[model samples]
Structure formats: structure tokens, C-alpha cells
Target: MTFQSVFRWFGRRGQSTVHQVDQDGQKEFTFRAVALGLIIGCLLCFTNLYFGLQTGWISMMSLQSALIGYLMSKFLPTPITAQENIVLQTTAVATGTMPLAAGFVGILPALGLLEEDRDGTPPVHLSWIASVGWSCAVAFFGVFLSPPIRKQVIIEEQLAFPSGTATAQLISVLHELPPPDTTLRQRRGYTELDTEETLNDELSPVEPTELERLHEAAKPEPEGWSSLTWSFLASGIMTLGAYFFPVIFSVPLFGNYLAKQWLWTFTPSLSYIGQGIIMGFPTTLSMNLGMLVGWGILSPISKHAGWAPGPVGDMTSGARGWILWTSLAIMCSDSLVSLGPVISEIVYKKLLRRSISLEDEEDKEDKEVEPDDRLVPMKWVIWGLSGSVVFGTILVWMVFGNEGIKPWATLVGFVMGGLLSVLGVRALGETDLNPVSGLGKISQLLFAWIQPGNVVANIIAGGVAEAGAQQAGDLMQDLKTGHLIRASPRAQFYGQLIGSFLSIIVTTTAYTLYNRAYQIPGPSFPAPTAYVWLGLARLLRDGDLPEKSNVFMLAFGLFFGLVSAIKTYASQRQRWYAKWIPSGVAFAIGFLNTPSFSIARLIGGVVEYIYYRQVGKENGGIRLIIIASGFVLGEGVVSVISLILRTFGVGVASCWGCAHGMCGGCPS
Candidate 1:
């Protein structure tokens, strides 16, 4: 679509009838589907908690959950409708993404003790119930804010919501029966009367009978079932084999040996490759560029200039600390600039009472739709928002006030969270990025100014804002998927609510267990994001800016970020310039992670690009996505299992220390 046409489509407020509606009106929000979703959601939440602590990134489980849910329905005595599968996936996404909001999983645990050097100082202890309560309240507050913007963003704005779109496609394909070749139809007990001629005759300007609808629904399984099943098994076995080589057999080459010795970073992770494929070329390329700049150039320059200590125990780890600060500068600036148009539009339309556009009489007719198409009642939305505010206020007071945070400051933070959530959702809608860390930094600066010298208040307020924004952006993406598939908004909302509650409980518990097993910021669990948050909070609280050289680097990063943001914004209008503008956030993320991971991701993106060119984008390239999803699912499941086994001191990797280049035999 042309830019103007696409813009108009997004700006048009109306319900969509893009997909085929279910004729049977079957049970979509059933007890069975929800139970299955909850089970899968909890599993995903646990794994995400573990993985996020390990890698500083959370894996997307929507596609995996959809495939598993669909496979389960197929093997069961009674099959679920496609709508039911969508609901299941939605719930799974809600829970799977919740780890992003949990303080322990993301930031809280890395704070460690307020006074670690003191003889009897206790560790930073956040009560499980308080964590769960605050997270749920903030997440629900985000959910409550989503319905009002659903029409503007999803229907009118037509955001891609990339993951959600992929899940919807998976649901459609898995639920569809094989195309009716005459032979195949006949074998499935279809009569000659069920042919196209008879079908047309039965539907000639008259309502089809129930029997006709039943006949339509009675088809064989999808044509690609064999390919999907075989691919899934093959990928799983491959992942299992790869997992054993480096871990069990002490094979250096299969792990990070090549990277350590030669700097040829190649991660043997199919899951990372899949993620790269999903992230696409622009993001992966930007990340690689960041890695090159941060480690290849900046680190060496800093060491030569006597600004950084020479070659530490872990060079990458030390360099990452500098990169983290640089990234914060870039992310904060880019996020604020990117949010300009969205914030302006919201203010103009809502607060200023200005008409967004002039609607013609014919346009009014086109916009007319049934009330049944609406997802949720306005009354429910109001009540939910009100309840969230009251409960959120109480939770904030009870949780933070006990630690000497002022009630007014807590209230201000809650209000700021709601405002930031609007920006968060808009950013996600526009760019498929949630600037949580940037939002947190912004919140921290704001709260530091409001409540100076109170580190507890600063951290708590910032956490609340970040958590709210992250959850809000995530839920809106889920809502977009629901809108696309014609799922009930009310049903999706309830699923989200249930999923969020379960996720808070499950992830918090998992975090506690994992923390006890392997202390965070130690050798195994780096918790890099948490470290960043803790460092930032301390810096703001103590008014300790970086040294002169580091400040120059930060300024350089800020300038680069501003230029990148401008180019990106300009490229939207001038599509020809798009290839020249890289994603700043992707670059920042690249610096935050190991170089090997980014290299693997880039390779995956290259593979995907070549495959797309060969197959053509319109010629059912979704099959490739399904295969990638299989690889991700296989590796992720195995990784989680490995971690669980290691928790009990069973099946620990023989090369664990060596793989990380900590052993004497390995290169530093």
C-alpha cells in the first residue's frame, strides 16, 4: 500500500470484517482452552524468567504456544475452533510477556543488598506477595487503558503487530482443513452434492441450512501437517544433539572457543537464529554495527587513552558497562523524539477537541457496524480502570511507603505510569519496540527531581512506570491480534487478566527459586539489565556522573542517536532512504548482548532474506516461519530442561566454566 493510503487506513476508525466468521458459533472461551492456556502460560513464564536473567532478553512464545495448543486440539477427542486457538495463544502471550514486568526477574534482584559490605546487612528482600500484587495492578492498569485506543491503533492505524500477526496466521492455517481435491473430499465422506455447483445452489440468495454449514466444517486435516510435524521433530532432535555436544562431551569448538581465540563469533543456537529471522534484516544489521562500534572500536580506544583498565578478567563484560551507559543516552533521546507525533496527535484529538478529519456522508455509512462487533463495554472499561487506580494506589502505598516512600510520590508515579503507557503503546504500534528501560530512566530522572536523595522512592517510582508501560504495550499488541482474528475483546481481556495474575505468581516464585540456586550477577546469571537499572538508580541518587572521557562518549552517543532518529523519521516519508537508516534500539541491544548472539541472528536474517527472494513473499512464506518457530520451540524447551536439571546438580555441563573462557586452558 502507498504511504498515504496506509495512513488513511490506520486513521480510519471502524470495525473490520477481514477474516471469515465462524458459522457454528462454537465455544471459544471454554474451560478446557483456558486451562490449557494457563498451563502453557505458566511454563513459558518460568522459562522466560530463567532466560531473561541469563541473557537480558525474553523470548516470544506466542507462536510456540499456538502450535502446541493446535497440536493438542488435533489429537484430542474433540477439536477446538480456530477462535478458541486464538484465545489460547492470546492468554499464552499475556503470561509469557509478564516476566518483563516482574522486578525480581528483570531488575529488583540485581540490586542485591543495600549495604553488602556491612557485617550484618540483610539482602534486598522484596516480599513475594507485594511483588505479585504491584505487578498485577500495574499490568491490569495497562490492559484497562488499551480498549480506548483499540480502534485508533488496530483498526484505523493498522499497526503490523508482527508477532501477533504471525500467531493469527498460524492459528488460521492449523485450524484449516486440507483444500478439497475431489478425491480427498470423497475419501472424507463428502457426497457429490457437496461439490461447488451444489454449494452455490444451496446458498443462492437464501440462508444456508445448518446441515450445509456442518458439511462445510467436515474436512480432513491441513495439507502441511506432515511437513510441520516432521520439521518440529527434526529440529527438536537437532537441538538436543547440539545441547549434548558442548555440555556433556566437553567439546570446545561447539561452544564459544572460536569466538574467544579468533574473534569469529558464531553461536550454535538455532533459537537465536530464529529470533534473528523474526527480527528481520534492519534490526540484525543495526545490532551487528553496534557490536562492531562498541567492542571493536570504543573498547580499544578507551584502553589506549588510559580511560579504561587494560583487558579485565572478562573484556566483554567490562566493555558492556560502558556500552550500557552509552545505550541509555541514545535510547532515552531516541524514544522521546519518536514519541513526538503520537503524543501530539493524542493531545490534539482528545484534549484539544479538534477534528482529526472531515468525514463525508458516504464515509459514515461505511463506518456503520453492529454493536456485537465491539470487543468490550465502555462501562466495564471504566470500572476496570477505576479499580486498577484504587488498587494500584493502595499497593504502591503499602509496598513502598513501608520503605519510607511518600504517599504523594507514589501517587504521582502511578499517574505518570498511565501517561507513559500511552506513549509505550504508541511506540509499539509504530515500531514494534517497547522502550521500557528508556521509560524507566525517564521516570527515574523525573522522580529524582521530585524526591531528591530518596533512592528507595526513585527506584520504586521508576519501576512502576516501566512495568506499566511494558505491560500496556504488550497487551495492546495482543488486542491487535484479537481484532484481526475477530476474537471477542471481552474474552481476550479476561484471558489477559487471568494470564497476568498467573504470570506474576509463577515468575515471582521462579525468580525466588532461581535466585537461591544461582545468585544473580554471578558467573551463571548475569542479569545485565538489572545491573543497569541498579547502577542508574545509584548514580541518580548520589549525583555521581561518569568521568570526563565517559561523558564525551555519552555525548557522542547522544548525537548519533539524534541523527539516527531524524533519519529514521525522515525515511518514513522518503522510503528510498530507508536502507540507510538503521534501528538505534537494535544497535543498543546488540551492545548489551554477546557478539556471538548477534552474529547468529544476522546469519538467520540473511538466510531468511535469501529464502524470501527465492520463494517470493506472497507465495506462502509462512511455512518458513513455522519451521523457524519449531527450531525456537525445540531449543527453548531443551534449554529450560537443562537449567532445571542443573538446579538439582544433575546433568551439569562439563564445559560450563571452559565455555565461558574462565578456565586456564581457554583464552582470556
Candidate 2:
């Protein structure tokens, strides 16, 4: 079937129901919406877990869920309003985050890997009931934390929760506003959203304005929708082509020999390009720069100098092993340092009973707060947070108390999770990325000090932070959607709670079933991030690290911290100069992944720059963001397709052919 036919099929199904509005008027929350949200959310939850195990990444699914909700709304018994649509997508997003939040794809699996000598045996220490209850309680507390910070970030600070904003726009355009072909927008005098000046980190400074402004921003012309449709289809096709015909991704630089050794393949993955667009120029450039410095320069030198004992591509004793410490150092230090002040400020204001907004804002709207009736009351937060913290701590202590995690330590973790959640929200607001894993790692580091070499304590502590940060970030993003649509915070919060509750039972069952079917860390299902978690645990337990690396790691960490500090300072004092500084976290990510991936990200960054220069969005042209969204969705589609294909034994999914020279076992 052609792409046009596919678009037409969706278009035919995506229309709003004429009977949607009754005389009493449609409600913002409904049984039909919640039911669909649960159904869709459960599917996405399983897929996310599967994807995370394979690729060490999990994507937020609000946009995709929203898209699906749009197409499926026609089948619902009662039609959903745009506000109700937020509830549906919010539920789906919350459910989908559970694998990572509950540690099925990270800490819990890592514990098993640590015990089974990487052979994928289940952890004897784990109890199914305890884990489920604890995970539920932990994720439960995260929902409460979002309400306290909603006004500060969304209203006064005006942080751009990009994915939330994008999803909000999508819902408004699809359900709330008139169709793009109509004259209603002109009649209402709704103007297009003007994107503000981007921060150094690519955060667009947009206010949480009225519902109409969001509609204007998201509503695309007919041609724009066509562009979005085509970009999405093309990206999916390209992903498939790259997989089947490796030649598409095997473009070489500086001849086959050097290119192969240097990992210089120009794999033009549209997914990476879409990421680059969302991640922005500075961050993507830093990733490429790190790839060059780490792989292009350091790897060759380390091998010849006998600093690394394994083969070039070997992860354990090669450049990958030694360099990761430095990467971890830079990432950890920068994340903490960059986020500390904001957390401190939030705390400082809370203590003083002072308003949290910065002193520079002039707009009356900036000081406005959502009515108390629409907001989540403090009583709910108190009962919810305390109840869950106490519940989660008891269960966690019961499960791992024998392993040296005292109940006090568990409480500390829950408390720390509440604090670190701010980091996740701030990062998501700015970058459309939540550094949950990073937050988790930091928690692990703290527990290393608190409990001192108890790997169980470290993992559980990390899990709490991971769960809290992810769920908190997810809620805030949904609330951003609610903010745009005039949905009640209390209603959305309850919808989020329903999803979180569902996730515990659904995700745990999915993981258990998948484990019985295959070796988790084995070839078919390499829970890659689990290995990172395992490594940290080993380092804590046995200090099993390579020699001659501490000095390098320390030096790099200090350098990264210094530069990050400068960047933070510059962002406030020297705005122009801040753009010139590389993001330490992004740059350090080079050591975390393959060389070719960074190069792909660089291609994306360059494409975005070129797009702005040439097309210019001159006088409200086709939406570039729609194309970016398409690329992301298309990539997700291919990932699911790829997973299914692999399940049926499509191919080994290996790269036998390098950009320069094909290996002897390659197809050619």
C-alpha cells in the first residue's frame, strides 16, 4: 500500500463524531476515554519494556498515544473532548513509563544479572508480591510531587515542556480547534504561535498561555499535514531500507581502512535526526565531538599503548571500558551541579514562604495561579506522599533488609527521590528529555556513601530515584497538556494514578513472562542498560575496574564540571557565550554508545541548522516540528516492526559490513 493510501485511511478514521456533544455538554473525564487509555497504555507498556531491554532506551509515548486516541476515538461509545483526550494520553504515558520506573528494565534485572553471573537467572532475593507492592507504592508517591511544583515551572518560570507542548498542540489541532481547511481560525482571529528565543540548551521560552494559543501553534495547514504525513512515512521506509540493505548506512569517510577503525559510518537514521532537532545544535554537536575525541583519538592510542588489553571493539577491557568512567564522571558531575541551584532555590522559597517566580517577570499572567478548586489540594499531597513513602519503605525493607538495606535507608531513598524529582522535571521541561537514569545513577552514588558498598542498597536507592523522577516528569508533562487545555489538575492527577496502578500489575507480569521465555541478558534480549547497573553494583561490591583509569576519570570529571559551571553562569550572565559551551552530559554520552550513533546525531543537527537557514519558516510556512514528530513516530513504528521481525527470526541483526570494508562473514 502507498503512503497516500495509508494517510487517507487514517484521515477517514480520525474525524470527530457529530454526536460527541450532548445538550448537557461533554465532560472532561469519561469512562470511554479511561478504558481506551488503559487498553492502549497496556500495549505501549509492554512494548516500552521490550524496547528498553533490547536498545537501552525508552521513549515517551504521549504523542503516539494521542495520535492513536485520535484514530480510535470514532470507536468509543462516547466521543472524547480535547480535554478528555489529555486524560487518555496522560494515562497511556504513565502506564508506558512503568518498566523504567519500576526497574524491570534497569535495577531489578541488573540484580539478577549480578547474581547469575550474567547468565540471566532470576534473583533469588526477589519476591514477586513484594516487588509489585513496592513498585506501586514508589510510583504512587511520584504523582503527588508534581502538584507542588506545577505553578513554579509551568506558570512563573515558563519552562517549555516541549513534548507536552507538542502533544497539547496536536490534541488542540485535532479535537479542540477547527479543521485546518476551515475559516474558523480566521474568524476567531487566532494567530499562529510565535516561538520565542531559544535558550542555550534549546529550551523555547513559551508561556503556559490560553488554550487558543496552543491551538494556533499546533494547527497546521493542509500542506503542513501532508508534509508531516510524508516525513513520517519516509522515515519509516528509510529505517526499513537501512536494516535490509546495509549499504544505505555504510557510507565511508577517508577510505575503508581508517573509516572502519574509526567507526566513521554515515548512518543517516532519521530517528537520530529527529532526536537532533529536538535535542538541538549544541547538544548534538557535543555528542559528535565526544565521539571523535573518544573513538577517533583515544581508542587508537589506548590500544597501542597497552592501556586497554582487549580488542578495539571489546567492551570490557577496551576503550569502551576505561572511557565510560570518564563519561560517567562528566555526566554525573554536570547533572548534579547544573540542577543543584534550582533545587536549592525551590527549597529556599518554600522555607521562606515567598513566591517562587524570578524577580524579572513583568506580565500579570506570570503571577497568576490556577484556582484552588482546579488544583490538587495540599491535603491530598500530604496523605498521598506520606502514605506511599511509608508503604514503599516497609515493603522495600522487607524485601532487601537481609541484604543490609535498613528501613532508614529506604526512607532516605524515598526522601531523596522527592528531592531529585526536580532535576527530572527541569530537564524534561527544557530538553523534552528526562534524565531518570542519570538521576538513578546519582542516587546510587549517594547510597554508596550512605550504606557503604551494599549493592542492594545502591540498586534499590537508584530504583526509587529512577521511579520517582520518571513518574514525576511524566505527570508534569501531562499537567502541561492540562494547563493548555484548561483541564482540571485534580482530574488529570487521578487519571495518572489509574495508569500508575495499572502499570505495576501489567509490567511485572509482562517481565515475568518474557523472562520465562528467553535469557534476558543473552543475545536475543540484551538488557544493555542492566549491564551498566550491574557494573556499578560490581564496582561497589568488588571495585572491579581497569588500572590506570582513575586519574583520567578524575581529570575529565573536573574539567567537565568546570565547563558546566561556566555554561550555567554564562546562561544567566553571558547568554551569547553559553551557546558556545558544549553540554557536558551530551558530550560525555559519546563514551556510552557506539561511534556511528553520534555521527548520525551530528547529521541531524546539521540538517536542522540548514532547515532554518533555507526555509526560514517564512511567514508561517509548513510546520518543521510536524516533520520532527513524524520522524520520531516513524522510528517507533519501525522499532516495533523490527522487534516482531526479530521474534520471527528475520535475520541476526548484526553489522558484519563496516563503512569501509565488509567483514569476511558479510552478505557481500
Candidate 3:
């Protein structure tokens, strides 16, 4: 199938299954499948944990798992069925996502760094058990919530679960039987030469005949694997060299550097650039606009008004505090407004007395008696939810009771998390985006109101809500994939459960090890997401309100957020003018981190745009995406390896901050 056809398949809504029958009946959940799935899932889980903490983004493992599984299946003595592949992908994705529960890892450790002994409160040191328990509780709650969400959103509402649909198509294509006498290469649109002379003549470096050149020109350009490999190697070598060589010899433009006099910072990060390419131009542009407003406009104005705490160039100083407050206000308002349509739809369907349409009624009746072997029983889901609530309640109280959080409050947090999960799932189903930060902010606000001046309570409560909602949305998306491929939902559910358990163990260990090796929110790590959460928690706990000018900025931000949301909503109705509205979250994200990171990402987006214009979307754009993905993965692996070396005291002088002169007294 063409790339365009696959793209179209993602957005189309109809029956879940594209194939009339399962290619391999009831072959899922085999030992080989489970073992391979577990291995792949654990690898990805570790990688995601490492990457997400370094950057604010986690790589989705569905496509990776599917591709890897397909290739691995070739070596098995018995044929690897599509159903088994579905189970494998589901397991890998679930495990990979579980580490996101530690999204709070960055924040929590940063809180430790920010703590002072003179304040009389103990330093924030979450035990390994507490970390594991909390992560598992939140993630499992999401898993339990997935089944009902799948039925409502995927089955009844027929929402476009884009990633899930694409994954399903990929599995179908992989498992499809080729026509007789057709080789795999032939099936994929490559012709086999009858002899070595034909192959060598076509590929000869010496002057080729016109026919040979034309034949070579007609052949598809070597892409996908070849492009990905070269890009991965190039990015990896560059990043590794920059990290190590900068100490021995400095290259002015190769490493992260700052020019405080000119109020400019440069961070040459392959990972950030890759993220920019993936996120596209609109998001990158929105982020740059935010940087302009916060650092360019607001910082100077605050400095002039004597509201700034330090020089405008110092991001760590209080010059950017107003920007944080204003951005939070904007993000909160935008998140709520974005939910209006989904809320309205739910209310109309549940409360209105309108009779069901005849066709819909018939469809519902057919759905009730459909002969589907893959359906996960509703009772299992209920039981799973009940067990999770019971265990989660006990764990939360056990882990957090010493921190002054009441058991009742933890329960309230869980309830709020479940409700928020419903919203998160709905949003993801329709738009393929989960408002995780928004949901977390809502929880933070609610808990802040309930128990003022309690930072521990606020963070923990908010973490539960955010983690649960995110996991729920992620799992429901996986279920959508299973549904489309006719994979047994019960088996998929089991796979998710096992994968989640493994994730909790693996991620918790990784977090503890990494934190022990490096200080978060410090010069080396610079956990940006943690900084935002820490800032908000401190503001709430210290009873500090936004300053007068900040309050004004907050109001303006809210107005801008609302306007953006309205434009986005209108754009969904095909309004041309409304389509130009930028994403509020992207803008807010720019303020959450240093300007250099946003600038690097914008550079990536610009390159992508130029590529699109020059080479068109079909041919070169797809190759660029593969190359970008390789760059991200390669950089992530090297970063993790460097961290591990640091943990073992190998080349300890060559830390992340050494290049930027943040590591004082390190060997020069």
C-alpha cells in the first residue's frame, strides 16, 4: 500500500476490522510471543524512562514493536501469527508507557534539591518501595479503566484512534500471505534480476549504458532502513564526540553555550531537533512566540519596572517567574475550553430524551450479538478496577501518610483520577492528543485549594491524577489497536498487566539508580518539567500569589488562551481563518524550559518545512521522518550510556555540565 493510503486509513471511521476474518485463529498469548514481548517491553521501558526524564517527551513503541516483531518472526520455526504480533505490540507499548508515571521523577527529585535543612522540614527522599507502589497504583488504575473506555469511545462513538488504526494496518500487512511465485521483494515492488550480470551492470560505477541508468533511476531510492541506519550512526557519533571532545578542545558552535552579554543561548541538541521535526512547524512556531513574549518582552518590561529579581539573562533568577504564572493561567484556561465539545456530546447523549436513530439502533443491536472472539468481558474490567482501587488506596495511605496526606484525600485523588481518565480517553480518541499536563494542573489546583501550604500533598495528589489519566488514555488506544486486528482482548489485557508490572519494577530501579548518580534540577540534569512543577508547588506552599503585573499578564494570557481554543474549535469545522491559531500548550512549554531548547526545536521545524517545500511530502518527507526518528533514538541511547558511566565513576569529569562551565573545577 502507498503511504497516502495508509495515512487515509488512519482517519477513516467504520468497522474496526478491515479484514473479513482472522488470518491466524486464536494463536495469541503463546510462550514465544509473551517472552519476546516481555523482552522488547522491558528494553523500551528503560529507554523511555531515560529519555523522558532527559527531555519531556516519551517515544511511542507501537511502530517499533510491530516492526521488530515482524522481523523476529521470520526466524521462528513456527509462523508468527498476526494475533501474536498484536499481543506483542500491546505488551511493549504498555510497558513503555508505564515509566511515564515517573513523569513526577523529575519533579520529586528536584523538590529534594530545592529543600533546605534550615526550614525544619525533612528533605524529600521517596523510598524505592514508595516509588514503585505509587507508579504501579496510578498505572494499573489506568489499565483497569481502559476496557470501558474502549467500548464507549472505540465501539459506540467510533472515534478515530489514529495510532491504533495505523498499527492494526501494519500487522495486517505483515501477516498477509503473498501471491504464489511472488518473492517478498517482488511483493514490496522490487524486481529480482535473473543473473549477476544484470544486477552488476545496473549498479556499475563505470560509465553505464543509457538503459542501465534509466533502470537504476526507475528503482526506488534506498530509504527506510538504509536512511535510518546512516542517520542514527551520524547523530550518535556527533553527539558522543561533542560530549567528550569539547573538554579536550572547544568548538564554539558544537556544544551548548551561552552569551549572557547578548542575552543569547545556543544548545545544539540532536534530540531536541528531532523532536521539533516530529512536532512540526506550528508547534515549534508557537513555542518561539512564547519565548519572544516571555524573555524578549516580559523580562525587559519587568526589569524596567523593578519587578525582576535579577539580570534578565539569568533564567534561574526570578525575571521569568511572571512568565510561568501567566503561562500556567493560559494553559489551564485553554485545557478547560478544549473539553467543551466533548462534554457537550456526553451530556447530550446521556441526558437528552431524544430517541436513537433507526440506523444507529440497528447498529447497536448488531453489535450486541456480533460473533467476536476478541471481546474482553465487562465483568473482568469491573473486577480489575475494584482490585486496583482497593490496592491503590492501601498503598497510597501506606506510602504518603507520613507526609501528612490523609487517607481520605488519597481516595479523593483516586476518584478524581478516574473521572479525569474518562476525559483524557475521550480527548485522545477524537484528537490523538491527551491533555495530561492540563489534567495534572486541575488536580494540583483542586488539592492546593483543599490543603493550602502542603507541597507534598499537592504534588502526590496531582501526580496520581495525571499518571492515571495518561495511562488510561494510552491503554484505551492500545485496545483500539487490538479491536481492529481481532486480537483477544482478554489476552491483550493480560499482556498489559504483565508488562505494567515489569515496567514498575524496571523504571523504579532505573529512577533510583539515575537519581543517585546525578542531581536533578541541577546543572547536569536541568530537568525542565520538574522546574515548572517545583515552581508551582513552592508558590502554593509559601502562600505567594502572582504580583500585580503578573496578575495582569495572567488575565491577558487567559484571554489569549480562550481565543486560541475558540479558533482551534472553529478550525475543526473547516474554517480557513481559524486554522492559523497556534497551540496554547506549545507556547506554555516554551516558558517551562530555557529559551535555548525551544530555539533548537524551532531550527528542526524550519529544516522540516524547507524539506517539504523543496522535495514535496511523498518522497523525501517520509525519509526525513525515519532519519529524524533514528537521530532521536541514537542520541537517547548515547545519553543513557553516558549516564550509566557516570554512575560507575568512569570519566566522571566529563559530565553534561562540563561543556557549559557549570561543573566547577573539573579538569580542563
Best by TM-score: 3
lDDT per residue (tens digit) for residues 248-338 in model 1? 2122443464445423344556666776665666667878887787667765665556555534224233545655667666666666766
Q: Please report, in order, the local distance difference test score of every candidate based on alpha carbons.
A: 0.60, 0.66, 0.63
As a TM-score, model 3 comes out at 0.81
For model 1, the local distance difference test gives: 0.60
The candidate, 1 or 3, that scores higher on lDDT is 3
Provide the TM-score for each candidate, comma-separated. Answer: 0.79, 0.76, 0.81
Clashes of each: 2, 1, 0
Model 2 global lDDT (CA atoms, 0 to 1): 0.66
Better candidate number, 1 or 2, judged by TM-score: 1
Candidate 2 versus the native: TM-score?
0.76
Quote the positional error of residue 261 for candidate 1 in Å: 9.9
* Model 3: residue 488 alpha-carbon error in angstroms: 2.6
Ranking by TM-score: 3, 1, 2
Off by over 4 Å in 2: 1-26, 31-81, 115-137, 151-266, 343-373, 377-379, 394-401, 404-408, 422-438, 502-531, 540-544, 617-622, 648-668
Error of 3 at 220 (Å): 9.2
